[model samples]
Target chain A: MAGQSQQINISDLDVPQLADVRKQLEEELTHLTNSFSQLKQAQAKFRSCIDSVKEVAPQNQGKTILVPLTNSLYVPGKLSDLENVIVDIGTGYYVKKTRAEAVKHYEGKIDYIRTNLETLQETIQKKQDNMSVVASILQSKLQAQASDKANKD
Target chain B: MSLEARLQAASSEYARLQAELSAAVESRQRLDAQLSENELVKKEFAVLTPNNTVYKLIGPVLVRQDPADARATVDKRLEFIRSEIKRVEAQLTDYDARTEKKKDEVCLFCFPPLSRRAHPPLHRQLVQIQAQIQAQGQHTAAATAATA
Candidate 1:
């Protein structure tokens, strides 16, 4: 009993213990929700990368554009290389890829993040179900105790 | 050592172990992120043609690199990160076991069973004595009524 794992019924727990479990579940849910939002933000970033790659088409070659030297600094420059763009692969490495290839790379990243979001959503749903179950059981226990006290009085 | 001192020591040890374990876990998470990033780069490298160029960013410039050499570098990094993760995992498990043992020691010191049995709580003893006196008074009242 001391070393082995055993499942205990939540209904058997007193009010304070049930409240503790609820609090823990609430914390986990919030953490998972934060991760979900972060993943969504990443997906948005990848989508924007795809759009930026598409914007640099061959038709736009030799066009004068305001290039960003800094966040608030833009320098007027002519677009020279429309066929190949330097893609920032992870770990501070960049690869020179054609326009189509850059789009594909960003698409792949978006797909990976989508899969992760799905799994995270499923986990959050399961935790929510557990939370509701614990909450209902706690409510019923409290009501029973209240009625018992009333009858004794 | 006194029980209080032992409990204090055990609790402090547990806290230290917890801090170290969290640090190890954080590093493991960082390594995992690095591993995944490298793997993504490796995948991109796989689909590259010989004409495609790879560059490593240094300070402020991109230096052209041989695709094969870049692949090798990424592979080596992945291997290193994998090894680091394994070592950290082992450390985490060891810390987990140590913390569990320390927690048990602290609990034993806090609620020593022998001391509890030898000297039950004062309120409980008082309650037992009061019940015994009430029972005796009731018995004496019944005896007087019988004599009358």
Candidate 2:
């Protein structure tokens, strides 16, 4: 793919043709960069979530807690065993885990997301570099075309 | 094919790929957010004892749930989310590969294949440029207002 695009001699194209190509590159690059930032934002939120869970887990241990009965009501309750926990994974599903084990699970998720973010960042950089090269070639061609028009006139 | 016709075809394909990529990314993020929420709940559940009264929200009411039952439910949910995340990630990977392929085939110049990155339709570029100009103008106006 790289070889095919590189083979195009920019000097062979006229001003309008070069401009058309440059415009397309700019739009595509804009889209790529936009998505990259969005992915970064999601990763940051996930990290903060992990930190919050880690901070709150220890304090709740062995405590007789007030369970919520409704949106605004609470019922007093005590745990039979502090060592056990039921985690709602999603879509009304539940799972059991120890507090320490749950924290480790979240930490592992954070690590996985971090790795994904890193890979995406690398790809964004490569796309940006490719866009810049295209821009440079387009600019030079446009400049040369202007000079040719001036000489002819 | 004429340059105009070829440009139209490539631009349309690029536009399609752009939309597909955005949708895939959005879905992936949503799934990740759901997973994070579940993990946080699991932490809370961990500190709870088996004999603790757990309230499960059934419809508008918080129905009493057996701690054992709650644990099993959450276990199932966690498993489902794990599988879902894998599925969504695979879909995202597939979309990313297709987008990359499309980009590679798109050569910016008059080449047969448009470079994977460049060559939007002229009208679309004009509209984008105009929008940017309008946004810049608004930014300056807001800055002046702040100064005033």
Candidate 3:
């Protein structure tokens, strides 16, 4: 499918066909937009993880802290090991890494998300462009039809 | 069977196929997501030393795991997801083809093949028939006036 490229002239399509094309493009654009926002949220979560990892500094070692086991419940605990933190890589797997390694892991995730976001943005831009072109073509076809009716009358 | 019944059956089948296709696509997306996540974990494991501690979260408890074992588990997961994706993709293509065939059947039932070849679409033919009737009525009215 990727090897084949078909160029369609939108102006040649009748109003109903053009409408169908526009509807398809609109659906695709909405899906892409939803994905973009989801990716952004994921990136934000990763950034927060980096910040939380940074908070576990050497200076804060042995400091008393309130750990929330639940959203509304907090348990008082002492920071035992500041150097080693467990990082959840994904898919229910966690790895023990040093503070630096954890930060690097999050940064890597953030970078991956960033690249994906860039490509998604490009795709969204292209779809929006196609949508506008289709819209304009549809408008012109409707105008032409109306003028034809006026001429007949 | 009656044409109306056939058209109804075709349309209903098309709708069912469409629903199934969407479900398949949704699962495919989920599998793709899981695959990418496992791949990321595998990449992370690649850089880790043999001494690094790996833990698998079973329920709420974290169980210590050998790095080699964890990597093997991730590899197996990746393989499973890949196979599942392939299966879903095949099902999607099958659904796509079926839906298209059903759509064509519905269209055929809506405008029979014979009439489609001889005239315009059903709606356009209805308009033409209405115009001809009106024209005939006007002609008869004019003839009656002349005879009177």
DockQ each candidate and list the results.
0.27, 0.08, 0.28
lDDT of 1 at B134: 35
Each model's TM-score, in the order given?
Answer: 0.84, 0.45, 0.83
Which portions of model 2 show Cα errors greater than 4 Å?
A1-11, A58-94, B1-148
Most DockQ-accurate candidate: 3
TM-score of the A chain in candidate 1: the value is: 0.92
Model 3: CA > 4 A from native: A1-7, B113-148
Candidates' chain A TM-scores: 0.92, 0.66, 0.92
lDDT values of the candidates? 0.77, 0.61, 0.77
lDDT of 3 at A89: 88
What is the per-residue lDDT of model 3 for residues B1-148, given as tens digits with 9 covering 90 to 100? Answer: 8544565565667667766766776787678778888998999999997656999999999999988888898899888999998898899789878866776666665544446456556546444543443343333323222221
Count of clashing residue pairs in every prediction: 0, 19, 0
lDDT of 2 by residue, A99-130 (tens): 56556655665676677678767766876786
Cα-based lDDT at residue A131, candidate 1: 91
Binned by DockQ into CAPRI classes (incorrect, acceptable, medium, high), candidate 2 is incorrect
Which one wins on TM-score? 1
